[model samples]
Target: MDIQTILQELELLSTERTKKTYIRNGAHEPLFGVATGAMKPLAKKLKKNQGIAEELYATGNYDAMYLAGMIADPSAMSEADFDRWMGTAYFYMISDYIVAVTLAETDIAQAVSDKWIASGKELFMSAGYSCYCWLLGNRKDEEFDQEKLNKMLEIVEKTIHNSPNRAKYAMNNFVTTVGISYMPLHERAVAVANAIGKVEVSSVKTKCNVPLASEAIQKAVDKGQLGFKRKNVRC
Candidate 1:
């Protein structure tokens, strides 16, 4: 489908409640606030469309940008292309959920994410760690280097508290994901989460919540979901 048609469909699907929720979560104007699940039918129709995805993403509409990620052909995106996308990701919803999730499907996921993690920019660091969480949840355990993941756990253990709020949240998610998905580092991740303890991240609404990685990991364990991996990273 063309950008205009898809955008019109997204607009028709948008609701005041969802728009308000998005606004509360830091989304600005020029957004339709269409729910993620509401976009599935259109996504199923278009499948992968890099050209259309780029067109939609460039519109700077939140729902359009999200649908772009849903239809984007990650294999066709170069690191430069991904970087371009990241540059426009102004908030955590766009940076972590859209750009990072799309990046997770690419072969350059690790290299690009590593650079972003070291970029020292808050949103970039958040997206970097979130990309790793997506990777760990979707990729096979054998695909990762155990030592690299170990060092990342060490990095989180040492620096998560000092990291930016969004990055801290993603870093905590990384620990929980590692504990749940990467069998080789399950114990190490559990230990890291225990050491890190409660992580407080401030929100736009002035509501601060402590995300406990240890609790999240234990919840997964309680469900017997250890070593779990997703079939797909994108919806």
Candidate 2:
């Protein structure tokens, strides 16, 4: 219900080993080493409380910031709140997942995505690409601007290989997300991914490899997972 209470809960969930691992993955101190799975039940209990969510994010605690995303009412949050969150985020997961998901749920998604991608900040640009990924995956064709989307694909084609590490990774994920989820864009997205080939994202802690976008989408197609729209981006 409050920052102290949630922080305490998260603290109890922290483990020294996980803390060390998280630090290597780009998270800093003041974060409890709580697993994301552990945060979900807590987030569910605090769901839809924008005020509490804001307080949690302002704590600058990684676990709490991620919790804020789970509880946020994206529709209720003002654009100013998102702006603050995006600009202040100190971790990749906060920017790429929490901030991106909230932005996708709002009407200003594409506008902010464009603005952030154009910025010099790596975090903002990564978040922007991540937001676009969610936007393209969850929204219907009628709701999207074909011109802008087309332009984004072109930008990826031209700049993805030279993008900042996380930005390149996010862009690749965006390609797979669109190619796998949007039927009409599948061919184009695959073409772009094939042309870009394997992407490299620097990760110090995780074994997670950046999948070739084309192969990832192709796997989805093989499993008949293509063309499935996610009703919500939170998952």
Provide TM-scores for the models. 0.97, 0.92
**How do the residues 1-235 of candidate 1 rate in per-residue lDDT, one tens digit apiece?**
6678888999999999999999888899899889999999989999889999999999999999999999999999999999999999999999999999999998999999999999989999999999999999999999999999999999999999899988998899999999999999999999999999988877656757666889999999999999899899998
Best-performing candidate as measured by TM-score: 1
Runs off by more than 4 Å, candidate 1: none
Error of 1 at 217 (Å): 0.9
Cα lDDT tens digits, model 2, 1-235, are 6689889998998888887878877889788788888888888777689889889888888888888898888898776778899877887788988999888999888888888899857889899989988887788877876667667888988998778878888888888887887777788889998999877766554545578998999899899898778887895
Clashes of 1: 0
Best by lDDT: 1
Clash-forming residue pairs, model 2: none
lDDT of each: 0.93, 0.84
**Which residue pairs come into collision in candidate 1?**
none
Location of the lowest summed lDDT over 10 successive residues in candidate 1 = 202-211
